[model samples]
Target: MINRISAVFLFLFFTLNASFAQQVLTFKGELAPIGDRVEILTDSNSTMSLRSALSSKEFKRSSGSQFPNLGTTPYSYWIRFTLKNESNSKAMGIQLTQSMMDYVDFYQVQGDSVTRTNFTGHRRPFNNRFVKHQTYIYQVPIIKGESQTIYLKVKSGKQLTLPIYVGSIEEVVENAMIIDLLFGIYLGIIMVMLLYNLFIYFSIRDITYLYYVSYLGIVMLTQASMQGYIFRFILPAYPEIADMFIYISTSLIGIAAIEFSKHFLSSKQYTPLLHRISYIFWALYGIQISLAIAGFHNFSYTMMLALAMVSAVYVLYMAVVIMLKGFRPAKFFLIAWTGFIFCVIIYVLKDFDLIFHYNNITNFTLLIGSAFEAIMLSFALADKINILKVEKEQSQLETLKALQENERIIKEQNVVLEARVIERTSELHEANEELNSTLENLKQTQSQLVESEKMASLGQLTAGIAHEINNPINFVTSNINPLKRDIDILLAALDEIEIVGLSDSTISAKQLRIKEYKEELDFDYLKVEINQLVKGINEGASRTAEIVKGLRVFSRLDEDDLKKADINQCLDSTMIIANNQLNNNIKVIMEYGELPLVECYAGKLNQVFLNIIINGIHAIHTKFGSTSGGELKIATYADEENVFINIYDNGIGMGPETQKKIFEPFFTTKDVGEGTGLGMSIAYNTIKKHKGQISVMSSPGEGSQFSLQIPIHNNQSLSHLN
Candidate 1:
C-alpha cells in the first residue's frame, strides 16, 4: 500500500514538472526573431555566475524589439529562453544576429547542471565559433516531447545588441543564402560604381572623381567589416584586425568624403569658411585613427561620430552656398548628402539608445546610405556636363547680342559721319582739323577696345600657368619641413656626441651612450632620407626651370621683328602656351619635313600658331570630348615655290559654307567674345603682308586642315618699310 502511494506521488511530480517546463517558443518553418518571450537579466558588474543567474528569479521579460539598444557598457547580460520541437524534426539551430559582440557564451540548462553549448565573440578567433559564418550560429538538440532551456551571456566593449533567431536546419540555410545573395548584389553595385568613377577619373583626371571613388571604397570596406564579411571570409583567425579595420575605414571615409565635397562643390572658391571647416574634420579623422590604434575605442568611436557630423554638415552647407550662386550640380549634391547625413544621425541616435532599436535599420543604414549617395552623386557628376553645355549656350547668346548691338552702333556712327561730311563740304578747310581730331579719338577708342578684348582672352591662361608652377613649388615646399626636422635631428645628435666627450664617463660607457642615441635617432634612416630630400629639391628646381623656359619660349617678347625663325620652333612654343587648354584626352603628332628658315615676325607667327592650336584643341574637345579619343597633327613641308605648313585636327570639321566665311572680319564659328572673330582674319592679313596665302579645306565629320604657304623670305620692300 505504501509503494503504490509513492509511485503515484512520483507520477504526479513528473507530470507537474513537464507541464510547467514545456511552455516553449517554437520555430515553425522560418527563422524567427526571438522577441519579448525571452527573459533578460542584467549583470551590472559582469561577474554573475551561471548557477546564481539560473537560481535567481530576477530576469524580466524583454522589451518588444528583437535587438535591445544597451548603449556602450562593460556590463554582462544574461538571457534565458525555452524552446520545444513542435514539429517532427529532432534538430534545430540558434543564431545570433549581432556580429560585433566581444564575448558571447551560450549554455544549456538541465536539472542542477549547466553545460556550455557554444562560444563566440569578436575578441575570440573567428574560427572558434560553432558555425563558420558572419552571424554566430549554434546547433541545438530538439526532442519531440521534451523541452530545453537556453541561457546566453553577452558582453562587449562596444554597444550591446542582442538579436537571436531560431530555426530548422533548412530554414537556417535558406536565410543565410538569402542574406549572402543580397550582400552580393549590394557589393556588386558598389564595385560597378567604383569602376565607373575610376574610368571617369582616368578620362578627365578630375580630382573630384578620385576622391569620390576612394570614399566609396572605404565606405564599402567599413560596411563589410561591420557585417562581419571581412572576419568571416577574409580573416577568420583575426577578428581583432577586422575590428580595427572598422574604425580605420570609418576615419578614412570621413577624410575622403570631405575632400570629395571640397572639389565637387568648389568649396574653396564658393565657401571659404566651409572649406576651412573641412580641414578641421580631416584633422579630427586623423586623431580618431590615432586613438583607435592606441586602443581607446570608445573615444575613437565618439570622434568618428563627430567627424562624420561635421563633414556632412560642411558638405551640405557648401552645396547650398554653391546652389545659391547658380551652380546646378550642387542641387544634386545637396540631395545625395542629405540621405547620408540622415543615416548617420539615425545610426548615432540608435547607438546611444535615444531612438528605438531596430536590427535591420541600424545594421544596414550605412550600406543603404552609401549606395544611394554613390548612385545619386554619379548622376550629379554626369549632370555637370549638361550644366556646362547650358552655360556655354548662354554665353554664346550674350556674345551674339553684344556683337549685333555693336554693329548697329557702328552703322549709326557711319551715317552721322556721312551727313557731317556732306554738310561741311562747303567749309572744307575749316572742318579739316576738327575731323582729323575726331578720327584720331575714334582710332584710340577702337584700339582700347581691341586691347581689352585681347586681355580678356589671354586671362584664361593665367590660372593654368599658376597651376603648372604651383605643383613644383608645392613639391619643394612640402619637402622643406621634413628636411628641416631631419637636419635638426642630426644636429641634436652631433651635440649629444660632444656632451658625451665632455662628460666624466669611461670610454665604454661613452661608446654605449653614443650607440643608444644613434639608434634612438634612427641614424641610418635619416642618412638615406637626407639624400632623398636633396634629390627631391633638385628635381623640383628643375621642374620649375622647365616651366619658366616654356613660358619664355611662348612669349618671344625679346624677338618681335621679322627674323629668320624655325617654323617648327614656333609651333613648339605655341603648343607650350596652349598646353593648358588642350584636352588631356587628345594626342598631338608632329610631322616636320625639311624646310628653310622662314623670315617672318616671330611674335606674329607665334600668335597665328596660338590661334590655330587653341582652335584645334577647342574643336577636338567639342567633338570627342574629354572622354573620347582625338588627335591633332602639325606638319610642315617646303616646295621650291613656298614653305607649306599645315595645322590639322581629327575633330568636328566645318562645311564649305562655314569655311567660306572663316576669314571674314567679325565672323566666327565660336562664341562672339570667345573668338573675337578676328583670329583667322588677322592670320589672313598677316600672311598677305608676308606675301603668303592661307586657306582651309574642311567637310562635315571629315576633319579640318588649315594650310599656309609662305615664301622662304618676305618681300624686301615690305620688310624694310614695315
Candidate 2:
C-alpha cells in the first residue's frame, strides 16, 4: 500500500491516459487510506517485475472506482505508488485487504532496482507471512522526511477487490481492534438467534426451524469465509479448504434459504406452482457449485450471484402470494426477505461494477442484511407461535359451542320421549283395568317395553357421544393455563429485548448483563416447553373435530327420510360413537368393501350397528372378564344389487334355543336393568323395514357371527315401517 506519495508522480502513463496531474500521497498522520491514490498496470501474462513495471510506463489510475476491483482475474496487477513520511515513526507497514490473492510481491525501488523485497500472499503458509496477520502486510523501511517509490504485484484465482491501507504499528492495531469489535457484535446477534431457534426446533420437532437454523449457519459460514476469519482462525494450515469454503457455503446458503421459505410460507399449500419452481433455482445453485468445483471460478461466481438474485426475488414473490392468501406469518417473512434481497441487489450490482464505488459498505452489505433478516425472521417464528395459541383457543371455543348445541338437542328429544313413555304407561294401565284380560294387558305392556328399549338405546348413544367428546376437551383445557404462562414468558423476554434495543447505551457494556439474563430466564427451556404445549393443544382440537364429524353422521335426526348413504361410513360413525364402551379391551377390526349407496334410514342403520357392537362388546366382557384379550371383527362386501355386512365376536356363544329367542321381543340374556331385551329384536325389525335379511350363527362356547344383507337398490315402500 502507498502510505504517502511525494509531489512527483512515480510511474509514467500512456500519453492518452496522462491527462491527470501528478499523483502523490505525503503521510502527516499515523494511518491513511491508500484506497484509490495509486495507479495500476495490468499484465496479461503476469510477467512484470519491479524494473520492468518502472520501464513499461503504462500504469493508469482508476478514476471512479474506489476499491480497485477486477473480479476473478487470473492475470497480474502491478500497483505503483510513492510514499513519503514526515512523521517521527518509522515502523510503517502496507496492508492488503484481499486475503485470497495467490501471491503478492512488494518491491521497494531505489534508483533503477529494488532495495527491499518482501513476499507474502494466500499461497504462503500462515507462518511464512512477513507479518503474522490474516491478510497480507509488508513492513516498509521508510525514515522520517524521506520519499520512496513502492511497486507491488498481485495475482489470484478469486475475485480481486484490493483495498490498501498504510499506517504505523499503533494506528493499524487500533483500526483492526475497532473492526474486530464491530464483528464481535454481529457474531453475538447470530449466536443468539441460532441458540434460541435451535432449542425451539428440537422441542417441537418442526422441520421449518431446522431449515431456518441451517440457513443461519450457512450465512454465518459464508460471511466468515469472505471476511477472512475462516482462514485466519478456522483453517489456517489448510489454505485449500479456506479457498473452497466460500463457494460451497454460497451454494448451500441458497439451498437452505429456499427450503426455509418453502416450508415457513407454506408455499406448496398456497402457491404450488411457485413451490415447484423453487426446485429449479435450487438445481441451478447446485450447478454453480459444480462449476466452482470443476475450476471455473469466474463463471461460477457470476452464475452464483445471478441465481441468488433470481431466487431471492422468487422467494419474495412466494411470500407475497402466501401473505395475500391470509397466511399471517408471511407478513414478517416478506419484510425480512425483502430487506435481504435489497441488500443482495446492491452487492451484486457493486460486484459487477455497475455501482462505481466499491467500498467496505457495499462489500459487506450481505452481512448487514443477513443480520437484520435473521432477527426479523425470529420475530416471524415467534408470531407463528402466538398464532397457534390463538387458533387453539378459537378451536376450543367452537367445540364447546357445538357441544352445548348438541346437548340441548339431545335434552329436548329426551323430554319428548319421556312424555310419550309416561302417556303410554298411563294408557296401558287404563286398558288393563278396562279389559280385565291377561292376554290384552300383556300385549300392551310388551308394546311399551319395545318403546322403552328404543329409549335405552338412545341413552347409550348419548353416553357414548359424551364420552368421546370429553377426553379431547380435557386435553385442551389442561394445556390452556400452561400455554398462557409460557407465552407470557416469551412476551416478557421480547419486551425486554425491545427496551434494551431502544436504549442508548453501548451494546458491549451491557453484553455481560444480557448473558446473565439469558441464563436466568432459560430461553431455551421455555421455548421448548411452549412448543410442546401448543402441539398438545393442536392434537386435542383435532381429535374433537373428528368426534364432531362422526357424531353428525351417527345422529342423523331425519330418521323417517330415506336417503342414499354409504354403509361403510354408517359403520365407521357407529364405531366412533361406541368408542367409549370399547375401552382398551375388545379390539375391533373392520374390513369394508366398496358398496353402492343404499337409500335407507341412515339413523336407523347407525342404531342397528350400535346395538350389535354393544352386544358383541358385552359378550366379550362376559367371556373374558374385560381383561383385554378379545377381538371383534366387522367386514362388509357388496354384490350386484346387494351389500353384505358380517360382524363376528370371539365370545361365549348361544345355542339354537337362545338363537331362536334372540330376535323375539322382551327376551334378553342380560340381567333386568342391564338391558331392555329388545336390541336384537329392534335390529331385526329395522332390517326388515329396509327389505333386508338378518341371520346369526353361534356355538355354545366359541363365538357368534351375525350377517346382514341389504339391497343396494331399495325400491320397497317404507310407510308401513313408519
Candidate 3:
C-alpha cells in the first residue's frame, strides 16, 4: 500500500513539472523603425509590427499619462514568445532595445510574481535617439526556438519609452520535482516513525511513548508545511489552507516540544518547578492552537516567539537540574536543545528579512533534536534496567552472606555446646564417684560409731560393777579397823577386872556379855563403812555422766538438715574442724560481726567454710614455709538481706593466669595426694546452691581476699538483696 502511494505522489510531482515546462516562452529579435511604428524582425525573417501588436485586443496599453514623455512618440508593446522544448531547458540569448531612450519600464512575470528588468539610476541609457536598427540578446532561453511562440510585452511608464523584448522562461520544474521527491521520502520516514510510536503508546499506555509520537508528528508536519509542500499539494484546492497549515504546524510543534520535555527529562522527579513551568507553556500552546484555527498568521508568529523564548529558558533550566542531579541522558538532551534554540533564533531573524537566504531552520532543528532524543531516551531506559539488575544482584549477595553467617554461627554454637556437654558429663561422673565414696565412708563411720557405743556401754557396766565391788571391799576393811580398836578397848577393861580379883566364874559371865556387845558394835560399824563406799561410787558415776554430756554437745548429730543456722556458729564450727590445718604458725584472726540466722545447708556450709579456711591456711603456710608466722583473717557479717563470710590470708598471692584457672576442676598447685582440686569447685557449686556469689581479689606478694555473700533466706531474698 505504501509503495502504491509513493508511486502516485511521484507521478503527480512529474506532472506538475510538465505543466510548469509548457507555460514558459523565449524571444530573440531585432527592433527597427518602419515609418511611424517600430517593427521587431526575427532571425527567421518574421516581422511583428509593434504598433499593430499593441493595437490588438489581446494587449492592454496604458493611457498617455502612463507612457514616458520623450521628444518622440512613446510606443511600447509586449508579446508572449512560445518556445519549443520549454520544459526541458532554460531559455537563453534574447535582447531588447529602446528606439527612443528616455523612459521605459519592463516587467517579466514568473510564477505569479513580477520583477522589473529595466536598469535604474545612472546605469540608464545615455541618448534618447532611435537608431536605424539595434540588435539585442536576452539572458532567458527560448524553447529550442522551434514550435513555441514567445510572449513579449513592452510597457513604458513615466519618462521612459522603449521597444521591450523578452526571452523564453527557463524551466525549473525538474529541480523542483527532485526536491519534492527528497522531501517526500523524509516525510514518509517521519510519518512512519510517528505512527509506529503511536501504536506503541496505544499498546503500552506509556505517556513517554505518546509524547514522542506527538513530537514526531508535529515536527514532520511543521517541516513539510514550512517547505511549501502543503501549498503545492494538499491545500491547492483551498488556497487559505496553505497559510493555515503553517500556523497549525507551528502551534503543534510548540505543544509537542513542551510535552516531550515533560516526559523526556522526567522533570516531575527532579525539577517540579520546571515541570509546572511546562504546564504554563502548555497553556500557551492552547492559545497558539486557537490562533492557528482562527487563521491569525501574525498572532501565530508572535506565539512562535513566545514559544521559542519560554522553551529555551525551560530547556536550559531542565539541563542544569539534570546535570546537578547527575542524570546522564541530559547531556545529549542539552546539546540537542541548544542546537534547536540556535536554529529558532536564525529562523526568527530570517522571517523579518534580517537575512536573505532560504531559512529551513525548523527542519534542521527537528531532525537533529529528534535523533538525539531517541538515542538518549534509549540510553535512559537501558540505564534504568541496569540499576534494577544491580540492586537485585546486591540483594541476592547480601541474603547469601546472611545465610552463610547464620550457618557459621550455628556451627560454632554446636561445637561449643558439644564441648560443654562432654565437660558436664565428666563433671557429673566425678560428682557421682565422690557421692558414692562419701556414702561408703559415712557407712563405715556409722559402723565404727556403733562399735564405739557398744564399747562405751560395756565400760559403763564394768565401771558400775567395779564400783559396787570396791564399795563392799572398803566396807570389810573399815569393819576390820573398828574391831581392832574395840579389841584394844576390851583388853584394857579385862586388866582392870583382874586387878579387882573376881576371877573365873565372873569371867564366864563377862564373856557372854562381851560377845553380845561385840556383835552390836560390829553391825553398826559395817553400816557406816557401806555408806562411805556408796558415796565414793556415786561421785565417780557423776564424773562419767559429765564426760558423756560433753561428747553429745560436740557432735551435734541430731541437727543435720538444712536450717536457719547462725553463720557465726557455722564459722566457729568450721574453724574448729580446720584447726589442724591452721597450726599455731598461722594466727587465726576472727572479725565476727552481728549476723542473722541464714537459711542454708549447715553441713554443706560447714564443709565449704572448712575448705576455704583450709585453703587459706595452706596459702599462708606455703608463704611462711610452715615456720614463719602468718595471719588468716576470717570475718562474718550480715545486712538486711545477706550474710557475708570473708576469709583473707596474708600469703603469696597468685598471678592472673593462675587465678583465672583457680576455680577450674582438676586444677591444683598442691601435691597430688594433698589436694583433690575439688575444694574451690565444690565451694562454687555449694555457694550457687545457696544463692550466693564468691569473688576474689589478689596480687602477687600481697594477701588474697575471698568474699562469700549468701542470702539470709531463700533465692527471692537474695534477689531483693542485690
Candidate 4:
C-alpha cells in the first residue's frame, strides 16, 4: 500500500511539471513574443492600484501579439504574463515596444507576496528607469525549473499599444542596434534635407530654402523627442523638459511650415483668403508654443492638437487654391501636404482609438510622413528655382528686345541729335569748370573747418590748464610778503645778539637787553610764523610740480613713438587733465590691477582716455541735471597676452540703438552743437590701429561699461625695445 501511494505522488508531480513546461515559451537564438501569453484587465476608473491589480481576479484573458487598441482613453491597463526559464540562459530581458507611455509599472509575484520591481515612465526622468534605455526593459529572474508571473500597468494620454518581447541580453542588444539603425537612417534623411536646403539658402539667398530648413529641423526634433531618441540621447538629464520640447517643437514646425508654404507658392499673390488663414494658423502655433514653454503643458498640448488639425486643413486649402490659380509649384506642394495630412489623420485616429493600430506604424507614422513630405517639398523647391530661372531668362530676352528697339530709334534720330550734341558740349565745359572751382573751394573750407575745431578744443584745454595753474601761483605770490617779513624780524634779532657780544656790557645787562629786543620783535611768534610760511611755499611748489607733470603726460611730449605705456598712469593723467569737468559732482574711482607695460601710441591713447572720461562726466551731468551725481569707475588689468581697461559709469545709459551706432561718425547723444560725435569714433579707430578692441555695454537706466582690450606684446613692443 505504501509503494502504491508513493507511485501516485510521483506521477502527480511529473504531470504538473509537464503542464508548467508546456505553458512556458522557450527561445534559443531569437526573441520570444510574450504578447500571446498576456491577459489584460481594463480599469476604466483607474481605481485598481498596483497592489489591488496584483491580487485582482477580475482580469480577462486575451491572446494576441499586442494590446488591444484603446486610443487616447482614460482607462488604465494591467497586463499579466507568466514567464518561465526552461533553458540554461540566465541573462534575459523583457522589452516593451511602446516607449512614450506616460506611466509604466512592473510587478513580480512570488507565492503570496507581490514585489513592485519598477515604476518608471516617459514623464519621469529617463535615468530613473531600472534599465536606462529608450524603451522600458525589465530583468527576469527565472531558474530552469521555476516559473514567474509578471504584471505591467500602463496609463497614458496617448493610445495604448504594447508589444512585448523576451530575449537574452545579446539578442536584446541586437534588436536595439537594428532599431537604432532604422532611426539613424530616418534621421540621416532629415539631416541631409536640412543641410541641403540650408546650403541652398546660403548659395542663392532664397527665403524658401530658409523656411524649408527651419520647418524640417523643427519637425525632425519634434519627431525625435516624441519617439524617445531625444530623451535617450539629447536631453536625458532634462527629462522634464522633454515633454515641453515636444509640444513646442511640434507647434513651431507648424509655424515654419505655414511660413514656408506662404512664401513657396506666393500665397499672398495667388490666394488671398488662404494666405490670411495661414497667418491665423501661424498665430495659433505661436500661442501653443508660448504656453508650453511657460509651463502650461496640458493646455498647450490640447491647443497644439487643435492647431495642427487646423494647419493641415489650411495646407490642403492653400494647395488647392494655388493649383486653381494655375501655379506650377502648387502640384508638388499639394502632393506633399496631402501625404503628410493623411499620415497625421491616421496617427490622430489611432491615438483616439478610432482605427486599427499597428505599434511601429502608429508610433512612427508622423516621421515617415514627414520624410515623404520633405522629399517631395525638396523636389518642389527645386522646381520652383528652375521656374524662376526660366522667368529671369524671359525677362532678359525682353530687356534685350527693348534695348534693340531703342537703338534703332536712336539711329533714326542721329542726324537731328548732332546739332544738340554741339550745344550740350559747350554747356558741359561750363559745368565742368564750375564743378572744379566748387570742389577746390569745398576742400579749403573743410580744411579750415577742421583747423578751427582743433583750435577751439585747444582754447578750452588752455583755459582749464590756466585755471589749474593760477591757484598754486596765487598761493605762492600771496605767501612771499609774509615770508619776507619773518626773515627781517629774524635778521633784526641776530643783529641785536651780535651787538651785545661786541659791546662792553655785563652778562646781566646783555641778558636784559636781549630779552627786551626779543619781546619787542615778538621773536617766538616770528619763529612759528616763518615755519608756517615755509610749509605753505613747499606745498604750493609741490602743487605746481603736480600740475606740470599732469600737463607733460597729457601732451605726451616724451611719447614720440611707440612706448611701454602704463595704462593706469594714462588714466591718472587723463583724470587730472579732465579735473575741471569731473572735479565737482562726478567722482572718479580707480581700481588698478598689477599690469605689464603695454606697447601703444601713448599720446593717441591719452586722447582716447580723455575723450571717454570727459564723455562720462558729461553723461553724469546730463543724467543728474545739476541735482545729484554718479560714479565713474576705471579699472586696469592685464592677462598673459593682453591688457584690459574697463571704464564704467552709473549714469543715464544708452539704448541699444545708440550703443550700436556709438562708434559711428557723427553719431552722438548730446544736444545739437554740444557734441561732435567724433570722440568715440576716433577712439575706436585709435584702439584698432594699435591692434586692440573697444566694446560697450549699456542699457537705459542701468549704466554703461566701455572695455578696451590691447595686446601686451605686439610688433611695436619688440620694435620699441630694439
* Best candidate (score: lDDT): 2
lDDT of 1 by residue, 431-513 (tens): 78789999999878766755554565568678877877787888799889999999999888889999999999999999999
Q: Each model's TM-score, in the order given?
A: 0.52, 0.55, 0.34, 0.53
- What's the best-to-worst order under lDDT? 2, 1, 4, 3
Compare the candidates by TM-score and give the number of the best one. 2
What local distance difference test score does each model get?
0.78, 0.81, 0.56, 0.77
Of candidates 3 and 2, the better by lDDT: 2
What is the lDDT for 249 in model 2? 86
Distance from true position, residue 496, model 4, in Å? 91
Q: Residues 265-329, candidate 3, lDDT per residue (tens digit)?
A: 78889888878877777677778768657645445555666676668767777877876898765
Off by over 4 Å in 4: 1-37, 43-47, 62-65, 86-88, 286-306, 418-722
> Total clashing residue pairs per candidate?
0, 6, 35, 1
Which segments of candidate 2 are over 4 A away from where they belong? 1-22, 49-51, 111-116, 415-722
- TM-score for candidate 1, please give it: 0.52
